[model samples]
Target: MSLDYTSHSHRPEPDELVPSRYALRIGEIDVLVISDGVLPLPTAMLAHNVDPAVRAAWLNDMFLPPDAFDWALNVVVARSGGQTILIDAGLGLDPDLNLPRAGQLVRRLEAAGIDLGSVTDVVLTHMHMDHIGGLLVDGVKDRLRPDLRIHVAAAEVEFWASPDFSHVSMPPGFPDALRSAAKRFVKEYRSQLRTFEEEHEVAPGVVVRRTGGHTPGHSVVRLASGGDRLTFAGDLVFAVGFDHPDWYNGFEHDPEESAQVRVRLLRELAANGELLVATHLPFPSIGRVALDGDVFRWVPTFWDY
Candidate 1:
């Protein structure tokens, strides 16, 4: 059955009846997966490289809507070595794109007792607005620790200087909005940024490594402690990516390279048998990857309270 989604029905309320945040531990590191809500994007955004008929068939098999569906916005918080790190800030409020259901990161963080001022570091997988917009919210900077360090890839910051949208296939005004958000973030937080070449350890077991594909400097966070492993894959992997590893996401700047990155990462994860969490994956997105013949499979872990 096709789903009929309406903005009003999905609008955020003062009190949420559904789950918003999930708490999990990677050995010793304290990890919290918080929902920034969901973005109702067009189905075309999922696999722009595929034919409409094929994409629609896939969506039907998955039991999702034919037009648009809510893509979960996940943000991660971790504490290690006396440092509180915020990984990929959530989408901030008041977007002109009519995505009012999203941008719930700040509020949800507050509810989770995550004080902005206590954030010692911010690990960015990239400079995309969705991954960095929460920090751009009004007065968020003021609330954050003045000594807070924002870690990102040097290539990512440089690319946004004059971002190339010729390779992207986004909705109307999205290109401009993304550019604006990235520009504003760098301008306001330039001094606070800590650019790394390849990889850098943010905390004891938390490392951010540059993996260029989705963008010039798309990165992923690897948390290893006491033999436990979990990786926060920013945008390189998506729900549709498992069956259609070659499918090009509209938001990807280099779709060809992105497929390469997606395949490599998926193979590694599948072999290593590590837990995985991603920004756009389903909430709490805690799961493992399994090799299913030539394709891959998503094995979402059972919820642990």
Candidate 2:
């Protein structure tokens, strides 16, 4: 099948409070989550809990109605010392997908006052369609920033680039777009790609820690400099209530492994008193992890600014 470069069908209405941009100043680093837009999820996607009641209770507790699902994509951008870093580009223009918000990433970055050409690095937590889809533009032959050094997990590079996994399941209305995007990443951008092992430093004060389970190469970023710290948790925890360390989203490639990584990540987040920015969390998705004895909780920021 050929790739479908359609935009998402459901976009933010004119009056919608879409969070296109925000910034967190951590000493010298400025971290941002550029809004790519929102997505409507099938309510049944998370029906993986052992008990239907448990799942329903989670939904209710999270104030999510049982029959509907909605989510937003907030891709990360960090700027420090003249270097602009973007983590996980959003879905770009795709004709067949009919997704409304798919192609607004670059525009959102511009809204945030960032020039695509100034982006020095692109860090991909994993190669899921929504995460890596914006790595390339519609007809452009290279990344939004051709000179940027792209960093991805070694395992993710292998898994997503493997030709045998072309027919994996994607969300409805889109069939082979994810696989096509991955292939394009490998073919055209491979030379600019740098794969790293767990706990490796991709830059000064920017560490990539393997938090696999969402994907074999799934990871989280730890940004620490000058005694201040924050973590870009990626998809480790999806929404507000999944704050429990053991709460793993059902979309994980390996649910059990995802849960394990979540547990470790939440524990560390709680112990170190670090701020968190999750991709699938609420807009302006910056927060801090709190520990309640052995459990974990999320305290969203009043202002990431």
Candidate 3:
């Protein structure tokens, strides 16, 4: 069975410059953060509520361009007890959305030696196109188990049924694209949808709780084992959120509520000191929150090899 030859070329496939996955542990749970690549978005999307000059100033302070930048799409895989859970799927179409990059979840998962059928549960943070599009790709459904359980908040499913975009400031075509994607996803996966009202535990120490702000049924997953803990804050908190928690991201369905939720979560995380990872933070977004005088701060964890 050992048929490997040492002569294999070192060149990487699947764009293996960094190989796209990070692994860590919390007590008995095994967690993996996978990069689905990055999406290039307008700088305004970072904070639509702030004055243009203020937004530009913050970007300048961070040494970033005042135009557009690549926002990472992070996906997580966790193994607790015998269940293999997928936190969120990445965007699957690139050119279709005018996003020439991203949608690499499927390829990256295979590169990391994870078989699609092995995933026992899928916990969607919300049904946004970027978060659920990877599952709608052609032939992707075939690779999944027929009995697979997809856990999502009941409000999330209902919101997409009649989505309202009056509050969001997304780029043109995004709202339409999102609606189509959500409708198609529901049609294709209705049989496996496992809707939860407020919270659900997919595996030991892995609990997903609804936190309505980003989306009506938006949720976050928390893992606690022994004394270790981590929270996967899906789209609720962003990189810029630390410096300006009230500044509204363009994607939030309810910007006011989202800001409130952001402040609350940031305060909680700052107080608890548990590890934090977010869907839109940088790749392998393992970090902690800290209250830096007035605004919050993001303290990233050093990479372990």
Off by over 4 Å in 3: 1-14
Model 3, 170-276: lDDT tens per residue? 99988999999999999999999999999998899999999999999999999999999999999999999999999999999999999999999999999999999
The RMSD of every model to the true structure, in order and in angstroms, is 6.2, 6.5, 3.5
**Residue lDDT tens for model 2, 1-305:** 00011112224346556546665567666676667887667544554444667777878887898866767787877766567778888777666677785557876665545667777888888877778777667654443566678888888888775533322233553435667878877887888898887767766778778778888898888888888898888888876334444544545777677778888777778788888887778777778888776667778878622
For candidate 3, the per-residue lDDT at 167 reads 96
Model 1 lDDT per residue over 174-257, tens place: 888989999999999999999999999999999999999999999999999999999999998899999999999999999999
- Cα lDDT for residue 155, model 3? 100
Q: Give the clashing residue pairs of candidate 3, or none.
A: none
Pairs in clash, predicted candidate 1 = none
